[model samples]
Target: MQARVTGHVQGVGFRYATAQRARELGIVGYARNRDDGSVEVGMAGHDDDVANLIDWLQTGPSAARVDQVTSEEIAPQSWTDFQTG
Candidate 1:
């Protein structure tokens, strides 16, 4: 699934935390800080794993005070490894 998470998502190690979370879930994709103070993520995995990821986005890391998380299911992409970009 592709998630276009927004609000208080940058400058808080959100991208790094996302990378670790994605790895823990055995997901393959990329996450990056968008220009508009939001973070974007693309991930591919089992339904449950994806769900768990989506759920975590709500709380984020200790430094992130996530105001919202928007997610949409998209066709999977080919990524060698999850990363921050």
Candidate 2:
């Protein structure tokens, strides 16, 4: 799945926390900061695990003030590990 999270998502350790959670859930993908001040995340894993990650992205790290999350199912990518950039 691909997700774009909005609101106070930048400079608050959101990407790092996302990577950590993804790793814990055995999800493989990436989290990146967008020029629009949103965080974009791509995840691929067990259906349940991916859902869990998406749920977590709603609130994100304590520092994140998530206002909106938009997601969609996408073609799966070949990612070996979760990362942030």
Candidate topping lDDT: 2
Clashes of each: 0, 0
lDDT value for model 1? 0.89
All candidates: TM-score: 0.94, 0.98
lDDT, each prediction: 0.89, 0.97
Task: Report per-prediction Cα RMSD to one decimal.
Answer: 0.9, 0.5
- Tens digit per residue, CA lDDT, model 1, 1-85: 8888877889999999999998999988999998899999999988899899989988889988888889988876888889898
lDDT, model 1, position 84: 96
Show the colliding residue pairs in model 2: none
Model 2 CA deviation exceeding 4 Å by range: none
Worst 10 residues of 2 by lDDT: 75-84
